[model samples]
Target: MNNPFPYSEDNKRYYTWSHYLKTKYKNKVFKVALNANFTCPNRDGTCGVGGCTFCSSYGSGDTIEDKFEPLDVQYESNLKIMQHKWPKGNAIAYFQAYTNTYGSVKQVSEMLKPFLFKDEIVAISLATRADCLSDEMIEYLDFVSRKKDIWIELGLQTTNDKIAKSLNRGHDYQCFLETVERLSKTNLKICVHLMNSLPGESKEDMIQNAYKVGQLPIHAIKIHMLYILKDTVLGKSYLQHPFPMLDKDDYIDVVVSQLEVLPKHIIIQRLTGDGMRGEQIGSEWMFKKTIVLNDIDKAMVARNTWQGKVLETK
Candidate 1:
């Protein structure tokens, strides 16, 4: 069957990040994940304590081989690994670990200045919290974006305030909306993260979370499944008192529904996430990422739907 999605070049019913980068750069482009050694307000005393219930001790930097190394060293090492796969591709300097923007503007400037002029770097993506972005930081990012593409990745796992509180997420939906509005006026691109199967969140809740955020002036979205890790608060709680998690079939169903609601223009950066094999306590089905993604594509074809189908109907 032919793919109906305007932004896709293959059978994908959703707009993939690969398609976006290829179209923009006119060649292969990959992200090099870097750890800036920043901390989150949720982890420190600034917001609350113990970090997010689902986050691991590495602040979700489990994939980084040596996170404690200096930024230049980390970038060179990770870039080599990525280049081994796509030798001709350009790189996006992805600040993936912790709240990269939680520090002072000067600290953030110093951390990012070197990469801004690097020949191999095409863009810089910073993973941060909505509350961490100050006006000064936004302005600085906007100024720098004039020279290079700057992407601000904000983690808003779920839209439900009750679920947000239960997860110990420092801010509410309002805070996310306010931050997005502020960032919308800048040259920076925005990517919001959402999670399915959050505790107490139904399939309908997950769909609405995508629908609500889809209406915002965001450039992209990353939809992840809530995988339990052994070291997290959620993991300990689950070990003591088990809660229901989405099986592979159900997860595929929910993800396909989420894609139908999101606009075709917004890039779908990630459909699922990888959990450290030794550290994961539940959701074993997530390990088979390829099969899960294939099933989602098959389901979308069977349903005769594409991304933004529901939006067009509305």
Candidate 2:
């Protein structure tokens, strides 16, 4: 593959997270996802109720194993999978379920304490909402960022407040901005999650959100298309009245356009995300994830473009 991006080994036209990890660790590093047994404010009525309309029962940590087991057991279980996938690789324990830092700073600390001592764990990734973070949480995360690699994945979805309201996102755009500003002070690697083809959002809306997050001090991003899952609010709505979804071709175009508008230095963590085959309902294109990603790569090459290719240089 022609890796013209200069930051990857494949034909990917953007800076890939895998490339960055390998370069930083000098070898392959995997994130062994763990279920920390946390709940979201959206689900618990702190922010609203019933959680985001699209979230699954696993709190988006569906890949995590042994939810009922201790952290040590979960770590070893995921480690075995990673070892088989990449036998020579190092790893980091990823606290991926719900609002990992929603609890008190002390509680969050205890959940992370075991992973801190693991020689094989090179970094820690926290997946949570920006508004869920408190001052105490930020202070503790900042402290850990100084000691080891601490990457925070904030679920921004889209910066459009209207869409946020429609999805029952609980927080507004300003809240996400404020949260980013706070985390910026710590200088930790931040990755934002973005969604495409959301209800009531046009293609332009997604591109503008891409432009906005690109201007932030974020180090990476994960781009996902909205997928309606069964037993959720979105699923109920879809059953009542089906909403338009991006097809495979349209999705690839949107993803490529997002990449073109983003800053080249921002690592592309994932091009798209998926729910379980059985649970996922809308956006049937999600089933062909590999093909969709390949299409994006091929489209970028055909257009002779790459990340930041459309951005105006100062």
Candidate 3:
């Protein structure tokens, strides 16, 4: 079968966003958001205590905090960014805020209808949770998929039950599996969010978790380094325990190893994440983010490794 990932050229992985967009559309496409203003279960007390251990109210908003304009404004501005950069390209209105599918089906459809009318928006990507993936929601997703490309992003931060509970993600591996099964039965594409070097998680655990994720029916993977942002539950825990974030070299080694085991066919949406400068609570290495990504690429090249090498052995 042909590789479905937009960026799979020459059977090698492409890592840049622009490259991925070009490859996906055979031209260019931007990810704009309609911002449905959905709330997360974690914050609503339906899940557990506070939100995910590493997630703050801003939802790791640092690089684009200033870009948090109104829904229409956000979409228009993002579209402008894409048009200015890739003049011939199109855009996708991605409902990227927390739990986009958490609202009623009618509400979601009504909110998203405006974007669908635009010629520039060829698809929609909804960032949501597994537990929130209801039958009605899947129906809506299938409905949207028929009109345009539909991508649903699920955060399965780690498969480790211990870490899931510790992070208060409020869902289990079973929940994630069920959600993927449901979506796979339909036509919606799936992307996953994972974090590495989280407190109380080990290198072995991270590798094992990635292997488990590889087994799931996912089309893309996004990996982010753990950050203890201030004013969050995880930040408070860090203050109490003072655990170390991954060192630059160690983090790169782990990321490279993970990539080696991750399916090369899967699109890599992100390699590193940015935390708010004032909110970042650990790791001097994080001060220079590119230093981390540069080291990861160099190490991968030197080792001649990609995401699924080690997993194949197992």
What's model 3's overall lDDT? 0.76
Candidate 2 vs 3: which has more TM-score = 2
| Two-way lDDT contest, 1 vs 2, winner | 1
lDDT, candidate 3, 37-152, per-residue tens: 66788878898656787877754433442246767777777677767887877887777767888878988888777777787777788888899989998988798788788889
In the range 1-314, model 2's lDDT, one tens digit per residue, is 36557775755789988888878999899889888889999989898888888887788877678876888898898899999989988997788888898899889899888877777888999999988889888988888776678899998899989889888889998999998999898857799999898888888888999999999998999998888888788888888999888888888888888998999899999998788888888567787878888888889988888899889454
TM-score of 3: 0.89
Clashes of each: 0, 0, 10
The candidate that wins on TM-score is: 1
Looking at candidate 2, the ten consecutive residues that score lowest on lDDT are: 1-10
Task: List the candidates' TM-scores in order.
Answer: 0.98, 0.96, 0.89
Q: Which model, 1 or 2, shows the larger TM-score?
A: 1
Residue pairs in clash, model 3: 259-306, 259-307, 260-306, 260-307, 260-308, 260-309, 261-307, 261-308, 262-307, 262-308
Candidate 1, residue 281: lDDT: 81
